[model samples]
Target chain A: MMPAALSEATPLLSVRDLTVRFRSGRETVTAIDRVSFDVPRGRVLGLVGESGSGKSVTALALMRLLSPDMAEIAGEVRFDGRDLVALPEGEMRRVRGRHLSMIFQEPMTSLNPIASIGNQICEPLRLHLGLGRKAARDRAAELLAMVAIPEPRRRLDQYPHELSGGMRQRVVIAMAIACEPRLIIADEPTTALDVTTQAQILDLLRDLQSRLGMAIVMITHDLGVVAEFADHVQVMYAGRGVERAAVRDVFGHPRHPYTGGLLRCIPDFDGDQDRLVGIDGTVPSLTNLPPGCAYAPRCERAQDDCRIVVPDLEAVAPAHRAACFHPLEFAREVSP
Target chain B: MLNYIARRLIYIPLSLLLVLCAAFVVLRATGNPIDIFLDPNHTPEQADVLTARLHLDQPILVQFVIYLRDVLRGDFGDSLQFGGPAMPAVLDRLGATLELLAAALGVALVLGIFGGIACAVWRDRTPDFLISTIAIAAQSMPSFWLGILLIQIFAVDLRWLPTSGRGDGWHLILPAATLAAFVLPNFVLITRTSMLEVMGEPFVVTGKAKGLSAAKLLFTHVFPNALNPILSFLGIQVGRLVAGSIVTETIFSWPGIGRLLIGSIFQRDVPIVLAGVVVVSLFIILANLIVDLLLSINDPRIRLG
Candidate 1:
């Protein structure tokens, strides 16, 4: 038997060399390139990137929700000592909802419009747990209350359209946690909400993660949310993770040029800078990517070598890595 | 919800009035039926009698008023071909038409929706292409031709069932199938497109992420959202089926309202023609109203609106 301490140290979910490519006509585009990370028990790992950085695709791939016909997925998704990528679909279904759940970006569209909020939440309970209707309904009511929805009983019969965006998202979260999943992959869960509601939802998620002891993969482009909630951070550029480290290390010493550029884009409250810094150039087309580092064209310090050799993730610190030929030194990092 | 229905109901009377006015003007302008009723060598007295009987000698405006009054009072006048009140003659044959419509609709909807969902689920694959080709063929073929072909194969050649006329349940199958085949393509295409659209929606992604089985996700989540457009298309299809039965019923010699309508038209039976138009129009309006009500019930957003 494994030691208790060793078992405790093992991450709940570990992804290695995850790659996803989409095919359209004759061209194949890599949406997620060699993405790898870990979500330890009861910890929050924020996956941050701009649009088209494969952040959403990574989450979808982790859930095995992407269409097999359109996307060709490779790599290992090891969850609880099981290799998920190799699991048959029938087996995967059992893992989903029971062990893993995902909250989508748009709350308005995530919940089934025709279904009542309670029914949607009760679905996973009924499907995975095989609970009878009455038991499921009672549990659904409990979940509504757990998500902090007022008048949970009355709201049970209300459809998704009848609920506000914030309320709808809470219903989505309630549904995600209905079967008490061990891990929840929330893809931009607050992107559709207002600022106040966004903060509240994030706070709720953090609180729920602690209470339920469920690890979370929070996929978002908002670094602010990442800073406040994430225990570890993975910064994606193009289709690959350019930097992966503890949240403080990622913010305090951003080694990848892409990560440093992204940090500079964030506005400082008391800083006298006239304008927030912006990353130059757009993301290269996935179908026709450059041979080297995807960010080489956009990196201010791009050398001739940076344009030719694809950099593999190299350790900059213990458990901290970056996929860049010329990583920023500690002195050159934007002061945290 | 009741208020929304009431608001929609207001359009019914307005539409009926317009239909009636158009039918009256067109019928009057087509010919002086009194002249046709009399021979060229006939006496003036015969002409006078025909004119007075039809109330055509009155001013057009007065004639319209009388016609409207008679219609309101349920006197659709006499059917020149059927030897009775036009309304009763039409209603008598209505049972057969309704039966045929119900059978055809059942076949069309079941096949169409199931076929559409299958195509969407297996999209871009061989099954999708195969089913789509068959649907297109079914849609393009003329119902009357198809009916005859079915009769040739099933009734004439195989001698499995009766060729024409309606009595036993078995007699209804051929005509119903023909009608169903004619309308099935629209249902299949509409349902497929609607389902494909909903399949791409974020909620469907959410449904899948919830670990729902493929069948469950499609039927429970995607199907309901896709249903609104399909239901609206179904309303129109219902009306089309009613109209289409005219051809199918005629070919099958099914003794339906459509056959009676054709006989009345041949005899220049003004009352029967006008009554048929108004009744069919009413049916169309009712179908639309039902579709709207069902849509509102299924989709909460429409109810809220």
Candidate 2:
């Protein structure tokens, strides 16, 4: 990990009190509540959480891809210096896929089935870079090659249905990086692929990040992925940030009880655990969350204070913070 | 692809044979065509001669065998009323029907697809509500009633178009619009449903994330993906329009094959009636073939097979 002082300079993307609420009929549910984090330049920030933890919503909000009538987002999304939340949609369109791009989950359904692979990749090139048809076509083939696709020139003329799941994902990655954006938000990018393919995709992403020097907000539920790829990590529970720290600090000295529970749940093949430990309950519904803390009911170290009052995320160690009145003590190193 | 087309072509003759048999059986059951030529002045011997000369005196099976042989040799007997070969007379009227069909189809496609896009894009809003309501109303209305209504409003009251008959482009407005109204509702409903489903697809969001403008995303991404269902529906509509035009053509007194078929049926003109049926069915079959080809072109997933 980089030294704290060296990584403390202005982040490439800084989100502050970012909130997203979805309105249906008369009721409004907060999907993301005052969530905040920073993605330093040329670094990966893993936003780890289970399903419905607002990770995907946070990614879409950052890109302003959510429909305004359904989702109401408020707060700051400062990218490189401009307040993206305040940027007009017309101007924001220019920033998206040019300076800030995204990679989505489920590569099987994320591409236009009717369009040729070449055309899909060329779309972003021509739209953002204003390249002509021939130039875009040439660039698209190059991008396919960049993603390590074999016979890139021939693959360009094929459709999504003609390619395998892993190959399609490579195309999606190529599209995301067409303009060499400064940051890429990858939301569960490998969740739909098989074990070996997932590893290969992650490896490809890591290689591209290091080579291109672009920041990434890696949103995933797999702690193994975070440990392997993310430089900094933030854990979320029921739409709120639960803990924030460097990857080593999070795994070595987990401060939040929820975070401790998550760590214990990861199966240890070498340790001879017969069964994996599991968190006791499901995530609370966003529309009907408890008054004090959403995770208090399922937390092992829940106290009266935890039940009655929600704890704010506070500094527990240097560059580490956890939202708990009784933060876990640094007992042992558990890096796997 | 060539093999697929050849396979599809093999089925046409078999279908046409079935259609011809059904037409022959139905017309024979409707009473002898010779009876329509009879009067009080005819003697019994003269009636028998008339029946034998027209080959109506033979058994139904023998008559069908002879009719099938003649049809295979490219021979449909002269029209009993018009005194000419039935095939040419029917083919002559095909141009008018095709003209009306083309005009109505053009109108339906433009209005239905755009209206559907508007409805899907503005889902749950005033435009969606209004367009859906109109589509439902249009779908429920009968073609003949709608045709008359158009004539009364545009031709009678406003005097903007002719009341009936085929003439210049001005004369086509009422009939084509009426025919279009019959199929337009289906187009709107199908397009709207297909478009709505596609808009929710992950690729659409992918397009949006690529910084594509909303219009580009809709036309290039959403609309093309939604086109498969619409194209299939268009095939069915073409067949319906050919048959449904009988009513519209009658209302406008347009000199199309539909009007000719109606006139021949009343006159008990068996040759002309059979010719009209075969011609119309052939058109429908060819239309379905074209639609299938277009579908394979539009979506590469459908490899003609």
Off by over 4 Å in 2: A1-8, B32-65
lDDT of 2 at A23: 95
Considering just the first chain, candidate 1 attains a TM-score of: 0.97
Report the poorest 10 consecutive residues by lDDT, candidate 2 chain B.
Answer: B31-40
| Cα lDDT, all candidates | 0.89, 0.92
Q: For model 1, how does the per-residue alpha-carbon lDDT over B209-281 read when each residue is reduced to its tens digit?
A: 7789999998888999999999989888877898899999899999998887787788788888888888888
Question: Whole-model lDDT, candidate 1?
Answer: 0.89
Residue A62 error, candidate 1, Å: 0.4
- Highest TM-score among the candidates is held by which one? 2
Residue B51 Cα positional deviation in candidate 1, in Å, after optimal superposition: 4.7
TM-score of each: 0.94, 0.95
lDDT of 2 at B126: 100
Candidate 2: give the clashing pairs: none
Query: CAPRI band of model 1?
Result: medium
